[model samples]
Target: MSEPTNLPVDPEPIREILKNHQQQIRLGLRMCAHCGLCADSCFLYRANDRAPEYMPSYKFLNSIGVLFKKKGKVGKPAVEEMGALVFENCVLCTRCYCPFGIDIPALITLGRRACRSQGVFRAYDK
Candidate 1:
């Protein structure tokens, strides 16, 4: 029920969060073979007719992956876009399967944190 903020992105906290989890994020991003093996494990993917964008790895790549790639220097619009991917698109069901055991939910959670750091999040009506 909270409203999204228009405040600009702050590099310090965002970088700090990324820095704390840099190793994990880097490994997840780099080790992802993009082979689509994890697709079947995602309910979103299966329920959405196996769309590529709904795949667990795809979500990670687009959300947290982008954050790491940009070194947490993304703008408000980028953060808002990530808000959709991480908060709206993902329910954090934690059912995603990865052959490499990439901990997809944790990565998505990181994405949520990154978005919140920029004052972007899901808004609900009361």
Candidate 2:
């Protein structure tokens, strides 16, 4: 609903946020190998006829991982797009079974919480 915010030009705030949540963010990003196993585990993916966007790994990798790569220096529009994956789409089924035993739900929740901290809640989130 807003234009590009041009946020965190200095990188300090992004760096501080990275310091705060570095471990899980890094862990989640590293653990996922994009094998698409978690996609089969997600009910949304199943119900949606295996649509690519409903895949948990796809959502997190594209949204949260992208944010981590950008070091949290995202605009409002970016956060909203991330929210589509992190909040609107995920049901947090805790079924994103990583063969590596990574906690997909936790990582996605972390992203949602980070967005929440930024007052980026979508009206559709229950």
Candidate 3:
């Protein structure tokens, strides 16, 4: 197999989009309290022995939430971390539930899109 490489990213367009699309993103991001109730919704989290980073909230919070908070000025390391969430951690199956009504699946999906737009993706996501 080929080696995994960090995704090449350009933050300018991402920053502009985050600035323009602050409507629902802000509310959606803040809705979660990282309560961990959404853990069961993901097979990866369940099968992985409930690892903290595998939880849906972690993916949502770290990916889109971080981007929103930083106004998309995230460095390469942050983008790589988001890739972990989007690629290896989350498959965007869209089958998620949140007791706190946070809609975790949608948030993760948004994160996936943002990462995709910035060319931050693994060729074969686990």
> Which candidate achieves the best lDDT against the true structure?
1
Worst 10 residues of 3 by lDDT: 1-10
Task: After superposing candidate 2 on the true structure, give the runs of residues whose Cα lies further than 4 Å from its correct spot.
Answer: 1-17, 124-126
Q: How many Å off is the CA of 84 in candidate 2?
A: 1.4
lDDT of 3 by residue, 10-122 (tens): 77777766776677678777677767788898899998998989898898888888898987887766777787787788777877788767777777767777777776666
Cα-based lDDT at residue 10, candidate 3: 79
| Candidate closer to the true structure by lDDT (higher is better), 1 or 3 | 1
C-alpha-based local distance difference test score of model 2: 0.73
Q: How many residue pairs clash in each candidate?
A: 0, 0, 0
Clashing pairs in 2: none
Ranking by lDDT: 1, 3, 2
Each prediction's TM-score versus the true structure: 0.90, 0.79, 0.83
All candidates' lDDT scores? 0.85, 0.73, 0.76
Error of 2 at 118 (Å): 2.4
- TM-score, model 2 to reference: 0.79
